[model samples]
Target: MVRKPDFKILYVDDEPKSLRYFKKTFSSDFIIVTADSGAEALDILSDAGNNIGILIADQRMPEMTGVEVIQKARSFAPEIVSLLITAYMDLDVALDAINGGHIFQFICKPWSTDSLKIMLLEAAQEYERNRHCLILEQKNRELEESRRTQERFIYTLSHEVRTPVGLSLNYSDALLESTLSEEQREYATSINVVNQSLLSVLDNTLDYSMWESGKLVLHEFPFKLSDLLERIEQAFGLQFKTANVNFVLKRSTEGIDNLVGDPDCLFQVLVNLLSNAIKYSAAGKEIELSIEILKSSDRSVDLRFAVTDTGEGIAKAIMDRLFKPFSQLQTAREGSGLGLLISKELVTMMGGEIGVNSEQGKGSEFWFEVEFWLGSDSSDGEEPLNGSRTVEGIPILLAEDSAVGQAMVDGLLSPGIQRGDR
Candidate 1:
């Protein structure tokens, strides 16, 4: 049998003859190191503790007892397996070694070679087991500390960054309500879009953290599926109109109007899909959203929602990691990279499966299938009027640092401009 590498056996005795005999007998089976006294054994340990796996000390030495040496050796390499060799069977010494927590076995002076070899093999195995356990324990502690640090950083970012973003959104909304020229309207719209995008990034970051911490919860209630689609159309209709892209929503042959589920989460997932479609597709490209009812019963209905886009299709390699957090494909446009990850998590929490199918040049289709409870009544299909068209006559104050933003604000609030020198 091959001996274990780096497993050194240290034999300590005041008598040189005993030490020499022990080394000569066991030198072939193990790396035997001889020490004349407790001091010499400790000196070897201090220099080669990492390589020394088993330490056997003779009792009744000149100055230090075996128990004392073993106890002191533990300070240098606490994981070393220790043994006590004695001619006299002193019960007190045996008890002391047993209770010290370091000694693994006690061998008499007249030990058979076979018995001593077996005990040493067992002691080496024990040392390895203890060392592995300590390594694993330390790894667990580091992981826990890292998680806590990430939690604190996310918390601080959410609180500190969102305040100004919220203020910018409100200011943009105020500007949109006021009367302005066509060019001025475009500028205000652009500003509103930028602020909204920033707010979206913030929201995605917060959602990712919540999901990672197992703190995200779903709230279910009665809602109309048709009404949800209508809201999505209104939200993206204006965006597509400005971008000159074709946006279509198709209902399946069999449609379910009323359902009981979390509307907010459903809306978020759809919005993320639509936003990506818009961001990646070139002008004049077509984007379509569809809903198909797969199965229906008295209590529940299974629906599959799909978004197909005629953009640059995802590569096979990129698609593999599409839903991973903070992972993004190389593109000219910028994104938070958390949208798809959050969308996948939300779909899973609602007991649904989300996936994507794409080809190199043929574009892509993303879909999710979820089951929801049937509602009591059907939807009326009444659409709400646009709020920006109705709300007017509110005096707005715009404080913007950027020149373009200031010009947009000034154009919106013309004829009431006041100048002050700085």
Candidate 2:
């Protein structure tokens, strides 16, 4: 490959006629800078260190040798490639210089112009390669530091804001449950909705930061597929109804019911797909989720989850950018543009693959397939509730610094405690 004259070559010799001859020989092919002595060569290197890509100097100079000149130039311009011009008798010293890393190669006294041009080109290419690696390494270090900073910010923000959001949501729930007029109940419900949205944003941010820092982890536990579907239907069924969309959850549950996996991550992935479907869909549109059993055995099972929506379908132009971080199909929506990317990451971490099928004017289907270990069968034909083991008789001690946080925790745990489930 050939590059334009972006780099310069510096040649040094004590003979003025030789310097002139060298420049005229390759003046059209390369950018050549000549120096008559070692001192002049060092001065040029000092001023144009970055632009000079290759350095070639005569071994026998007036004050200092070419090896000394190249070694000194390397102190400030280590990325430059160096070659020695020597006679037959100076071959031994040139060999020492090459072995000691003072020069890259040596040329004989009566060098062929074609051979010398080829050597110079190779030297320039070597300099380019080294410079490219240095730049790439620097960029990687910067990216690593940025990821660390983002992780720290996510931690600090969550620690400070979680209590307040939790308090607001639980208090709103409490207020709605108490006796109140219709308007008051509606206002409390609105507060609950807003707080839930804020909490979702916070969760997504924290997940993205953890993923960037390679700290995102998935926990495995046993859960019933029916319960998982029930929770999702209970959570988003009303949202679909309110939007006047026909929503259905089709569960193919004949294969396996009890499985071990990360429920939270699977839930979030479904939620992201459903949320996007809700945004582009209009009234009277159709949205459906299908959970199909693909393969099953006594030890493990593989299943496919798909979300289909009849909305203004994705355009062909922007389809490839769907899963990229910070890329959105539509700029008018409200989001960090990380939902699809986060889903992809979570699905991959769980040993699954995600994809989409869409047309310009038709609807779209987003699907993923994952494998889960089968849980041990229960003799009583009963599974643990949402992956939580039995802790009915255990004494529990809760701790929190904020009163609001304590109240929220107490409110959340009271129902389970009353039912003697935890």
Candidate 3:
């Protein structure tokens, strides 16, 4: 069934007989309102509010010419499709009207009924097309502005949150270094966990804004998959103590070595999946980070990484919002909610895809697929990074603008390493 259009046609002429003939001819196929004079037509257009889609006016009206009426009608209905009717041959006037864009077309004294119908319908379609195009352009502008506003809010909020979060982490680190009772140590551990989560959220917001603005930076380096998993395991190994969750890295048995990719970005995406799993799981529950080799070639290998947890599964109602920022499920534990969003973005940047599968009563498995170029571990003449590298008495200059960044560098550096001003 065809949906009827909601707009109406407006015909203006000084002759009452012409008005009655136009209504009798086209009233069955179109909704129309008639005006006997240009002044009356302007009043109808001004009061019609958007109901008028087309206007057919007589050129030989005593008060005003058709071109004059159409030109002035624009003040009320700028996009109205217009056609002029004339009883005499006036090619110069017709050319001026068409060239000036005051009228869509001119009809001779005796117009064929069939030809006039076709022209009127075509003008209606043209009006519809132009209206839709203008609406689309306006919507696009609004969407762009909304995205800019969101980015600005994220940036402002991230900076405002940075100072307090950094102070909290610095304090927690100091407290952890000192000897403490079991309860005090547990309290410090909890604080550190929250601090790490905040840092992760801040990092994600910044990364997302950067990605949206086309300023995200990525690095490619050579490293073994096993080594990267081991590092993540070690980092999470300490954090898992707070919840007493069993965190395991189920590495693939394939001979995956010397992979070249953005390790930091991949690491962050994996950490997001794993941390989310940890958030939803209970104490004593096990969470597995597994990898599988999908396809391998001479220079590149495709792989799938998954983090599965035996926690209460997700509800279907919130699944659509799973990867949107600040849409964390209402669970026993709190989360930043930006992890999965940024994870999806990072995975895409790494030429990968990410998703999750779950049943309400069972558990959830969040997964991502990525491809990496195969290369030697060493680049240039420098030795490959390893666990035992030493930098005794080596002076390194630091130039970081973030307080948490400077503190992280400070903590990661060895005791023998010296830091100097650049």
lDDT, candidates in the order shown: 0.81, 0.82, 0.82
How much does candidate 3 score in TM-score? 0.62
lDDT of 2 at 78: 86
Candidate 2, residues 197-308, lDDT tens digits: the string is 5765677777887888789999999887877888777556546755678888888868577789999889888878887787678889889899988888878888999999
Q: TM-score rank, highest first?
A: 2, 1, 3
> Which ten contiguous residues of candidate 2 have the minimum total lDDT?
413-422
TM-score of each prediction? 0.63, 0.66, 0.62
Candidate 2 matches the true fold with a TM-score of: 0.66
Sort by lDDT, best first: what order? 2, 3, 1
lDDT, residue 400, candidate 2: 88
TM-score of 1: 0.63
lDDT of 2 at 383: 66
Clashes of 2: 0
Q: Candidate 3 lDDT, tens digit per residue, 343-408?
A: 988898899998899887688999999999987655457765663466546899989997667866
Error of 3 at 99 (Å): 7.5
Candidate 2 pairs with clashing backbones: none
